[model samples]
Target chain A: MNKRKSKNVFINGAISSEFIGQSIAKHQSKTTIGAHNIFLGQVRADEIDGKKVSAIEYTAHEDMASIKFHEIREETFSKFDLTCMHIYHSLGSVKAGEICLFVFVSSPRRKEVFSALEYVVEEIKAKIPVFGKEIFEDESHQWKVNS
Target chain B: MILHIKYFGLLAEVTGCNEETLEFSKNSVSDVLSILFEKYPDLKEKDFQVAQNNEIVSKEMVISEGEIALLPPFSGG
Candidate 1:
């Protein structure tokens, strides 16, 4: 429909289970949507050099990251038969095992969402200029790199 | 020309400032980078990308109008 305007996609901290539940509840009114696919990215407790990761502090070049997010949304909409889509990423510190990224896509059928969801998530991981500092349990930190 | 330069992630950690306006008499992005490397030798050992006017740019790109940013590898989910 092309009516999806650029929206703020960042939250100050982790995305709570309550928020996810409410989002699903809000979509109950959209009877036209038959299937919804969701992807939740959890921070891993990665260990490096005898240190365990405790949390991740996220930062972004906000203006550019927002613009990139909008482009990814537009591209996904054009490529898939999605009724609606939403993406949210965490800013600030998110503890390990907490949700940092959430992508929800709805369609009339199940198959469209299956592929569209992955596409959007992959594009974001590759393109967005968001950075993370992995804080170790001992208070030391290292930069995270996507590979 | 005076350019607004931004640093993010590891680049900011190395540069010690999030952003600053610098006077550079360079013709290309690489030329400006050389000056930065001279000022902060630690930066040369790390990997990063350059963005001009919010677009990722190569070192050969000409230095032109707009803000410049030095971005480290992205780790966003």
Candidate 2:
């Protein structure tokens, strides 16, 4: 609603759908954009070797995670020209096949929307401080962090 | 001085806790690792990267008060 508060990022324990919806509505957007692209990253149960990944226990050094997210948010905004953007990522434990990160990008034009959305998602994946622990179906586990 | 360190990933399992306060002088990240590896001999090989207050730091990075010393491996996607 305020000029200075349209773009924001929520890096938290677990992102709720309501929070995602609210972040979008903050723009009070009336552009009537021809396209709006959204990407939701959900955890999927998979088998590694003979081990099945039943769930992911997500954790982060909270202070650092928040700082990282904030920096990424500011960078994405400066790089992309869009009507609005919002990013939310899960912290603590997120089960297998559950949503862990949600990114939404909207613009008046479809072409810019696609490119901006992709860039934001990629940057978040590459730079954010989130960590994952893959829980095997048999209850064994291992941590999953990006290289 | 006592340094309260936090462990993530394989390091946490090896240490048996997410955090521990240890005795050490005011030193760089490398110094902390030298002490920790001596205490938990098994941790030397896993090869953790050090972070002070969430940013990627080098071995010579100095740590001060109220900072979370992290031993995390690269695990981002």
Residue B31 lDDT (model 1) = 93
Candidate whose TM-score is highest? 1
**Best model per lDDT:** 1
Give the per-residue lDDT digits (tens) of candidate 1, residues A1-147.
Answer: 677899999999999999999988999999999999999999999989889999999999999999999999999999999999999999999999999999999999999999999999999999999999999999999999887
- Tens-digit per-residue lDDT, B1-77, candidate 2: 66768887677888788887777885777887888888888888786666776777898877774455455554443
Model 2, runs deviating above 4 Å: A1-28, A32-34, A145-147, B74-77
DockQ (C-alpha based) per candidate is 0.91, 0.47
Docking class of 2: acceptable
lDDT of 2 by residue, A47-78 (tens): 78899887777766667666776776666667
Q: Clashes in model 1: which pairs? A: none
Q: Provide the clash count, candidate 1.
A: 0
Worst 10 residues of 1 chain B by lDDT: B63-72
Candidate 2: the clashing residue pairs are A43-A97, A145-B75, A145-B76, A146-B75, A146-B76
Model 1, span B1-77: residue lDDT tens: 88999999999989999999999987599999999999999999999999988889999999876799999988998
